[model samples]
Target: MGYFRCMLRNRVSLYLVLAGGSRGNGDGDEATTPALALGGEGGIVADLISCLEAVLEEKSGELAFPGLRQVFMLNNKDAIVRRAVRSDLAMFLLSGWARAREERMDRYIKSYLDVSWTPVMSRLAAVAAKPATVTVLRRRRDPLATFNSVLENACSAQRCWKVPRPVLRHVLRRTVSEHVMPAYRRCVEEVEQPAAVRTER
Candidate 1:
């Protein structure tokens, strides 16, 4: 039974990659078009969702295959595939699969945010903390510039834009609480502190 389940998981993962047009090797390359000819078709989308649901419903008491989930979560390079997967996942959640897997879904969203936003936030934080050169000072002086730039780029990303409205709202709420608020607080403290004190620290 264990071996059978493992084989089932491997098969499902392969199907997910092909159905979602994700690259097989997990490089950051653009996702190839699914040769299954399942681009944005409702049937293929439903099948993908059903497969994911079955995996989530397993009695193992843990997510069966995280790599497969990551593939589904991050496969946004192709427009048709992105739309189909995004819409289908959203519908699956809305249709009540999320009730039992709420924590799992939250984890997925957090992982997505970590992947998509963490680097941008880290870079901005580094720029903010640097010696107050002309360029860095300009950015720090008007933090809105930094924030808006990040927001614009995030909104433009395929992964961010493809997220469903409800899921996006949840993501924004978490982002505000977990990242933006803390960062904004630090920025304010830094701006208000005397340069001598900051330098001393």
Candidate 2:
């Protein structure tokens, strides 16, 4: 397990570094690098996601479901492991390679959200249900702040900002909205507002 983990980490790091270094240098530049060439053909990204799916499958085999374990593995304490799971996954989701494998990428995106952003939104929804916690002022202003924080962390921590604008819009934005907006709307509606105070004339 350790050897496989180490090898995966090194390959991911090397590919990312090579890809970044090659960009904007010249026309047809990135394709010259073997790693980037494989990435262009969706090989590396596909393999990485396949490995993640295998890990999830193995964890699921231990019990009927392992949602918490999936979350823990994706958000692991080790920076390299965490980056490999979260940041690299985000890169793949927003890459041109994903366009050629839409169904696979879509499934991975759903799995990614099931483990990451969905839980945070669930907690927010739970908190919003409590009248004491979400006071009138908080209901009006604080939820947006909290939501912004969540959105920022979701994008920034996963390096979503590093992708091209069109890819980010078409892929990440749409996926986030589908998963988050409905829950956000529910939370907004569920928040218990305080009774209106009447002003004496």
Candidate 3:
């Protein structure tokens, strides 16, 4: 039991990269957070997958569920421990991965809406500030490039997240449609509009 627990703890430590590193608790000293020290979002996610795979490989034979509907005799403490180890390890990994993904996605969304969108929106505001001729062909912001860059970042993050196949697909589809699509549409409209019409609004 102790050995199993130790293995579980080691696996989790590798998963989070919280062990074997200088760490900060986010208080104030300017030390790097564990996630950041581990090499940012992508690295943490990759480590998570690697650790999970390693644990599964190490415990495969012992982790098989041998019963139909689920039958575990309470009197058998060994059986209970085996069941707990398998189930608990899975739960811990999945919950931790989900949390990491959630935080990463939130950060990406905030960047998209705030920092990434700023340049184009600022240009739009500039146009709106002053009237101009429709055919002047003055230098204008290219939101398409910005939108594409943001989309690429989101896609890369999703690929590295490695949660589960179905969950990853759902997250990517929903995030792209909800966040990137609207910005894309707005960019298209702005680009197609004549200069005078753009600035007028």
Top-TM-score structure, candidate number: 1
Extract clashing residue pairs from model 2. Answer: none
* Order of models, best TM-score first: 1, 2, 3
What lDDT, from 0 to 1, does candidate 2 have?
0.52
Query: What would the TM-scores of all predictions be?
Result: 0.42, 0.38, 0.32
lDDT: worst 10-residue window of model 3 = 67-76
Tens digits of per-residue lDDT for model 2 on 139-168?
A: 467655666676677666555223333543
**Deviation of model 1 at 86, angstroms:** 22
Of models 2 and 3, which has the larger TM-score? 2
Best by lDDT: 2
Clash pairs (backbone) in predicted model 1: none
Query: For candidate 1, lDDT tens digit of each residue in 1-201?
Result: 232334335655645655565445466665333433443433343455546545544532352332234324422212222343344233222243334344555565667567666756775576467634424465547644676677667556534343444554565467646875677667656655566776686
Worst 10 residues of 2 by lDDT: 192-201
Off by over 4 Å in 2: 1-101, 136-148, 159-169, 195-201
Clashes of 2: 0
TM-score of 2: 0.38
Residue-level lDDT of model 3, residues 112-199, one tens digit each, is 3454344435554443333343234335544345445545654554353332345534653575467545655665566667776665
Per-residue lDDT of 139 in model 3: 50
